[model samples]
Target chain A: MKLSIKTIIPIIVILTACTDDIINNDASPSNIFRSFWEIMDERYVFFEEKGVNWDSIYFDYQPVFDTVRSNSAMIKAFDSILSHINDKHLSIVSNDGHYAGMFLNDTLHYSISFGKVYSTYDFSNLQTYSHLHLAQLPEGISYIRILPGLKKINVNDLNIRQYDYSNGLIIDLRDCTGGYMSGYNFCSIFLQDERVVFYKQTKAGKGHNDFSGLIPLKIKGENIIKKETPLIVLINRNTYSMGNGIASILKENTNAFLIGETTGGGGGSVMSVLLPAGWSLTFTQSKHYNLARKLIENGINPDIENIPLIDFWKEEHLDTGKDPQIEIAISILQTTK
Target chain B: MKITLFLILIYLGGSTLLVAQEEETKSRGTLHNFRFGIGPIAYKNYYSIPNGLAGGSMSFTYQMEKEHKTKKRDFLLRANFDYSYLENSKVLTTSEPLFRRFKIRLGPGLLWPLNLKNNQLHLQAGGNISFYGEYIYPTESGGKHIYHPIPYGNWSINCNALIVARYQAGRITIEESLKVAIFTAGFFPEFQYTPTSIDNSYYWDFLKINTISTIPNYRMIENKIAIYFPLANNQTAISWRISYNHYNFENSQKYIEHNLGVGIRF
Candidate 1:
């Protein structure tokens, strides 16, 4: 049978309209989440290691899910929450993770490459180091410069991997937006106390946990080198989420002196959902804490506030080869300790 | 409300078109035909007596067209029925009466068609005569009641002169026309006396009720002036006819009602 011209045209028009609707309809989560959940449940290698109850996990989380209202907010929430996990190997991979710094974006990726370290007063010479930069100033103070969350560099790896620390150490967190909270994993190299390592802030309030035995780094296969080296940590406004979190951990338990700008205020552990529409959303799962639930959302402030070194970099056109705030720690070690 | 009734008329007309087509082949050359239709209907009347008044009627449409030998001109005879009622309630507190009335019309006209690509232009002009068929009135006295009906005929007349232009686009053709009808004289004794009472002064109020003698023995004439636009094609088309009908009673009272109808061409 043959169709008339009039019938054919209307049929074509109706089909085109239906196709338009199909393309525009957003994919709902119900379709994508089930398969993803099934795959992870059956095949994830770390399913047993992480001690995660995959089935109960979905059921418990499903009822409390809220739709992400905006994209930017989702990214921010994702970055903050992922940073709180404190495991160097685990971190959210996204384009926004580059907030740590332009140089960090280049160097800090999933894999770690060990290289020579150097430091300079001028940031314009940062590329000169080509690897991590370690600066020794006028005093017995040492500065270790690098952005966090850009690498899978665990503290155990660092402790085992040879590095000399003869003077008071200055850890720079300026412009360090944040990454995994595992900075405390290497604390044993300088801190010996097992009292308070960090604070985990949940809805119920603050809970203190000791990382003293968490990352056990064994040196020479015999003794635990618990170096009580006096530490001075430097932070700036960009010392966000996990950066502030680690700083809070160090401040309460160790001899670390916090200096320079106040840390970025970002509390809560983030929960993320990969939407069926190929979009992702991240939200705060729980609150944050400092000392006994002191200041949940408010960030960690420094012992002394110093002018942001970026201001001087802007004024003098001298891009410090490393975080100048960390240079401040090296300078403080020369004068005070 | 008038438009609603007109839609029902068209719906019934649609079914009639299908039924009528079965009996008659598409008429060729010159043709004249009449269409009769009716449907189940119920509505509240607005007369001063029986408030809920419900009734139905058979509508008639007649169209006659003849092609001229020399020119593409055609003479057409058309007729339509405009039936309605205004019913009121039994004597509750207001000692007013209630009644219902129906109107009908017939028109004859000529048309000139100009051929065009994808459409046709038609210029048509026509005139018509219209009147009521019956009037029913009910009276009440505190505890007593009475009912009555009066046969009314050929009460109003109107001469409609319309110049319409029509265009056919595929299955749809649209026509717009201007019409002006002048009221002639009534058909009964109503063409004589003039009453000044408020109730009788308003021709519409009296036309709405039913009374034997009180049904004024006067001429009820109407003049309609309007612009009508109808879009239609071979199978189906929607016609929107908007017109103003003015009533002139011998009682020296004048009233006007607006009319609109959506019709389908067979």
Candidate 2:
């Protein structure tokens, strides 16, 4: 009935020991690698589409991970294994900085510089708003350049009514890396009727092929721009993800003509998971497809493939005459009139 | 020097008066105490964060005790609410996220005296039906703008067993209490297939994915030790408490917390 400090200390120690079985805190390289592999196997949605043999990946990388003694070595080993799947959305970020699966080294070859486009053209009423750059090109053409992300914007404040697009409108989406799917809002501005732009499916279970039913991505008809107006979308290999997606939607649903090289494909929605080693891994968790049920992960082809000859990186090459994509769009609009 | 002497005299007189008042009210029928505490807390919730989070916790507790003729037949009721703001231990950058936790508990029990030797040492066994709910979520927007932050939470009704011991040495009382959840019925979320978002029926989805858990999958333990020192007024006491809690569910999610706080009981 009497309890002493000695009795209490021992009882506390015993109870603490009993609770130790609850969590596993193993931080060994092999355990971390297994955890990483298991998470990818369960959550990653592109395994079958990318033709990734996940089991083979584990078989090849497990031994290397087991022998790695340092964090840097483990990261390097992860980078080597992850490179097999060429998904730019997939990346590993640790204290050492971010390591991406794929880098767009040839972006300059396919895209024109936004700075050059801004400076070269005698654009009137130039205004850089949130997520949008508005300017007036010659012959009553409206030039609207979309920025990276599709953060919510006040459509009314955009003063879009002030622009006269009787000749045409150009939606420049070059080098628009990616952002939220809310970019659909920008696409809806020119839509004449409600249209299904794409279909998307997210993971439903742990299995690689487990996915929810395809949900149609739809944009409502705002008809801010007249349906009769000629719309031209400029894109290049540097336009990716939502940028590429918006281009495809506008090209397929609207009377718009896409003029540029093929878009950089990144159709998946990405999600991140924190690993036990203090590193975070981001990968695609959803798949996107065009209205025809064809996968859009490989990039969308333009209606008229026009690659500019001018070196976009050079300030001296910033000339409207040298930008064949823009020149062709202007000529087409002139002929239509 | 004269003013200092006068102050010392007044302090001694007040202490004598407080002691006299304490003796007069030695046998009271019912007692009520309110305690508010704030202290550092070390926390980890494996469901949301992999590493430990360091933060501060604030708690408010109200207790009512009904005294009886026999020491064994004492009735007690307690209710507590606690809030904690815990951040990742890593140096926070713009990308790093912060998390917060909320908890509330209510319990009613009877204490039975195990030993009443010398009236200075008291040991008691207590049993309570306790209801507890805890929720943890990110305080900031998550890593990238694309991903939605998922929150982890659980609620449980438990049969709690407590062993409480108190020793009085002069003007200080030292108390140690160990509480263990002997039986628990817990509700926890199943493994999520996708992150929750506004576009989906996330609330309904969460309801459909909930699972009931029992002792085999849920376990909880808490131990607290406190030292109380009576103030000059004798009606109020200041105490310092240190508590440790461990909760595990489904063998996959674990939460641990350590708290050190100072409070006033009146």
Candidate 3:
């Protein structure tokens, strides 16, 4: 049959369109996996430091992926590849932008009441600490209340730079929803050694920016600091992110006691991305590791487990009693040689 | 004139009754007899970036059983839409390159089944019309930041035909659909078909690296068959499909998306 231009072009178009369709489909395992890896490898800010080889990993996994006859199998294979990185943060976010097992938290309220507060030694009535409150127990344990920001106390300004670690220190990390890792520098004065407190894991190429290993406690000029002092850290549900990181560090490195509720489970090395969609995706690129190699995704369970002091004393209604949890730590410290 | 009038009256009367019979017969069949579906939507683009982007969409459908003469054949229709986009950074932000299409779309086709009840087997074929739309190019330093309307200059349309088969039991149904389109014909002859709009104007640009390159051809191509499942009960129905989409331009493939939402049937 002599094909007319109308029939010929459309016939050719049909065949050509079929070929093009085959070329651009996105559900193939190789393409799906490669696209995922490509986005992470190209966009993750710390690809190199996290030790990922995007291309080789994709190549190695592609055949295995192609062999998978089912989507369940494909997902299992993908997960296996992800787990190999040992990162909690590296994960496949659903197209809708929510991670599995993550929930938004906006609970826990703390009040600030204090006996005294100051910033400098010249001590002009000590400008009351904003965003931070101070509380002192009759038993000599002092409480510094802070939110997400760093609550720094220069060791020299503790008034006890002149005195030694005689009395136990109670750092109230309760109500702290988390802030910068720099907060650890100010909080580490009570630690004795540079110890691995946590490890962060990430897929080598997919945007896993991990803290690598435990944040050790190393004071300037001094090899050993607060070696004999018994430290007690307080936490509650409000503690999150780096707040949990701090608690984990202290738990692994010092003789500190943790009091209050388990922390929010926000453990993961984050790779922050400014997507073309305008919002940011702070993806979990790595899993968190304690010095013991134990992953700490669920926030740390406290050592003493006390409710907030105000609630604990709700029945007594007394303004001047010892915080029972802090009292317990002091009791334990008083007996320490 | 009297004879002509009589014939016209007879023809009009016959057609009116035929249409009425078709409607009456169609209403007799149960609405949720057999479920059918198509692959999800797909999009690929690159008029502004280095390697372009690509993805896909999927859906499911259900047809009523034969209730009257109109529903006797168990005929039902299926639909699909797919596309790809590609961009090159080598082209300067300002000077108009040999060509640029901010975004392009190539699908939204239909399918019909010959039989939907006997062992859930059927012979099927349908057609689709694919068209392209415009996209805005991003600005650059020392380059003019402006918006120019091409008014379908880069826009073109292609036609498609597909073969499909399906199986259904109770509330569960599985289906596969294969398609061929004229737009696919004009692409790479060996692997893809090129559309008329793409003919001669852009080809082999990806093979050569220049100060500017055409968007990758892979984004405009379709690479895999798709599976569709339409789930239904009393109050709500949904179609879920999954397919592989690819872009040789970016050397990437993605099992991106395939899902649909449908209202409940009585």
Candidate 4:
């Protein structure tokens, strides 16, 4: 094809005419605040459920942000803005350290500490994996304690057949914060059948309510634990994310009874992104729902609620046989047997 | 850095020697050139890494040109790959994020000689339709099975305006080419998400067609300068090239690369 210089010159001119610079080059307070707000507005998944008025937040914070000068002030302003949302999955990290929502600052109370239980309990044939502890309590009851940040749990290592669950089995998930969703596989050993445990939906667009179709999350039952075996799951406000998910699964699918306080709600899938101002922001990217089609973001409720008297975080309470939750669990298992 | 400087100095010295030698011209029916390059690259993806990653890039290109009395028609195919390492920090530990990129471009163009007074100066103007694809991923630390590497990809059919200028100095030919994307129909993810599975459904969701123009949504410009010296047999020639490329997608994701290469034309 032959083209004249005149035609080519005009084409080039027209092409160059449609340009916009979207990148914020300056780190001014207003720019930083705008970037943070805009990023959350575009990516955060819980505005509708959390009842966050994002446009109103922008209007309110734009004035506050304009007055901010230092990075510390900026962080404080950001924290203030995030405080309006109740999502525990949301956090911002900078050189100043990690800043999270109000839920994180609320001092969650957990019933039992695995460290104390290991030091205090009379257990036999103990097995420890990364983030998992398996042992046997008295009366032929099996005890499994799951810790936070559970990445991988090999069912083979648990030696499912070696232990006896004739009396009952206790799965302790207290204070277990979020980890890989695959960590829910720990429940596969007790699953009675292949079942859809929950559903998840991710943000699909810029709109607040824009979400993808629900993707059912299924877990196959390994039948390692027989249907007649008694299973008890322990949960508290500290049990979150995958921990919350496991508790819900055990309650709905298996005959496992839940004991302890309502779980710390962190049902959403968390993802982190780097902001233009060098701060990293983490927020929920997907919403998780239980089999009942209810949002698990607030947490899953236990069958029998028990609040701990001793502070689990305090070392003085460590290894004390005074944990009422464990005693109640033992009593319940004995009664069931 | 020192080796790069030394090689550049040698290239300049060789070019000067060729410029001082006798001037010559050759007419050929078809010419093929193959090039290989490696150089340091600075990269960043706003969706993945916060800081700019320092890395190296390697590229290979093959070109075939059909020469006529007044014009040259050329077909070009090129591929470039990059690997960058993130610096360890408080947030990112042991298994730090590593950025990797691969790009492929193919196009055919027509070039017509421009009327100029100086015999040494040869200029041509035309455009080409290029098919371009790029895949970029910043690997996150964790068990590979658990943590999905979020990928940034661009697949576009673009119309590129091309400008080529050649100057004959002694027995060496100094050539410069400029190509700029004028219009693009492309696919880029509006938001970053880890695909639930490596399936066609995820690809369909991620690869929605988004038309972008040079003015606002997307922009790409590539410039290359090469010096060619004919071999003793006159059937083949050795060349050195330096090129710079800049790309902006949706004004949010940006990429810049520089390359120094050695080539042979037959």
In candidate 3, position B86 carries an lDDT of 24
TM-score of chain A, every prediction, order shown: 0.53, 0.87, 0.53, 0.87
lDDT digits (tens) for residues A82-109 of candidate 1? 3433222222222222121122332122
Model 2 regions lying over 4 Å from their true place: A1-32, A67-73, A98-100, A104-111, A154-157, A166-168, A182-185, A188-199, A215-230, A248-255, A309-322, A334-337, B1-215, B218-229, B232-252
Please give, for residues B168-243, the per-residue lDDT of candidate 4 as tens digits: 7776777767887888877765553554321124566656676566734566777666777777644233333333
lDDT order, best first, reads 4, 2, 3, 1
Please name the candidate that would achieve the greatest DockQ relative to the true structure: 4
- TM-score winner: 4
lDDT of each: 0.40, 0.66, 0.42, 0.67
lDDT of 2 by residue, B1-266 (tens): 24223423433333333323221113336667677767555555443444444566778878787767665366879898889886433322334445678888898987777855446556778888888887877665444421333467767778888887665555655556777777776566543334432133344554442444455445566766666667764435433334455555431455444444455555
Q: lDDT score, residue B241, model 4?
A: 36
DockQ sort, best first: 4, 2, 3, 1
| Comparing 3 and 4 on lDDT, the stronger one | 4
Where's the lowest-lDDT run of ten residues in candidate 1 chain A? A210-219
Docking class of 1: incorrect
Model 2: pairs clashing at backbone N, Cα or C within 3 Å:
none
Q: DockQ values for all predictions?
A: 0.00, 0.12, 0.01, 0.14
| Residue-level lDDT tens digits of model 4 in A1-337 | 0233344335333322221122234457787667678778877888888898999999999998789777677778877877798677777665345454555675354335565566576778888888887888889799988887786466766775888878999998887876767788777788767777788887777778778888787777777888888888888878888788888878888898899889888887776655544455677778888888899888888889887554543544564545667778989999988
Model 3 docking category:
incorrect
Candidate 2, residue A169: CA error in Å?
3.4
